[model samples]
Target: MNKKLKNLVKESYNNGQLDQETVVYIAARLSRKDLKHYISLLKQEEAKHEVLVTSAEKLSSEDVGKIQKLYPGMNVIHSVDKSMINGVRIVENNKEYEINLNRTFHDIIGFLSTHD
Candidate 1:
């Protein structure tokens, strides 16, 4: 039954007619457990690459636009963290790019420790 539903979802998506009505109809036919599994599978199939930006303050529209341009096709989720101090940290697909003052300070401390 799950396999049948998987195939149906795949076919429907491929046919480009998997709309809200079709989703409601399919969901109505699924058991609670099956619905959860189906939704997870669907998410995997239609997963959008995400870019998460965390900063001490909210980014300006221009800054957000620049970030979006750098990571085209990715869904950006911005958040604020006072601990960041300044600058922003970008996280995408489990990879992190830190450009915050706190991180820089930490890096400098680590470097000095290693040198001394």
Candidate 2:
């Protein structure tokens, strides 16, 4: 994607500052292949701004709110994973933060094995 077009696309989608007329004007200038590449780039950019929070069970609205507060300006998505066995696993900016029974045990086992 062209840097200028990429920036305009991000700005238009993220802030909704660009009007419909402006979007139509921009789209009119791009070729079919360029448009497809732009759409793919847009999807990748969208994913970067999302926060995926998965836990062993559904989180309460209050809990979700707390997580949302932590990641201001970014979209927060919650999911359930019973294998986590409780606690949360937050994935943001391509990094994983896991705090759960499974992680705890793994840590303990690794520690004991290394110390022996």
Candidate 3:
């Protein structure tokens, strides 16, 4: 392509408004003879940016060590709950395991039998 068209493309791409894939897509439309070059560039850029929107919560080294030692074959998917309060509840491999803090709380366990 000519210098003017190349400059416009480079500007739009570097501005980050249009990602590399979109830039290459426009390039392909304009440069039918060199579409293969743009396609390869698009694939490379896409691979590099695929993880941009995919991020997980950070886990500390201690946490990872604990998981490796205790859970063996388990891979923890990071998550949170608003009602988690001060403790954790783990649902692993289709089984529910609840661990709760016993502070400033009331439990009516076996109350019916004792009161009657």
Off by over 4 Å in 3: 1-60, 102-116
Q: Each candidate's TM vs. the true structure?
A: 0.62, 0.69, 0.35
Looking at model 3, report the run of 10 residues with the lowest lDDT sum.
Answer: 48-57
User: Model 1 has how many clashing residue pairs?
Assistant: 0
Tens digit per residue, CA lDDT, model 3, 1-116:
45555454455465444466666557656666556555555454334332211112344668656655656544455455534444555555445565544321434444655686
- Pairs clashing in candidate 2? none
lDDT of 2 by residue, 35-94 (tens): 777667666777778999999989989999999899998899888999889889999977
| TM-score-sorted candidate list, best first | 2, 1, 3
Which residue runs does candidate 2 get wrong by more than 4 Å? 1-5, 14-36
**Which candidate number maximizes lDDT?**
2
Candidate 3 backbone collisions, by pair: none
Judged by whole-model lDDT over C-alpha atoms, candidate 1 comes out at 0.81
Please identify model 1 stretches exceeding 4 Å from their true place.
1-18, 42-50, 107-115
Question: Which residue pairs collide, candidate 1?
Answer: none
Ranked by lDDT from best down, the candidates are: 2, 1, 3
Q: How many backbone clashes does candidate 2 have?
A: 0
Looking at candidate 1, the ten consecutive residues that score lowest on lDDT are 11-20
Model 2, 48: alpha-carbon shift in Å?
3.7
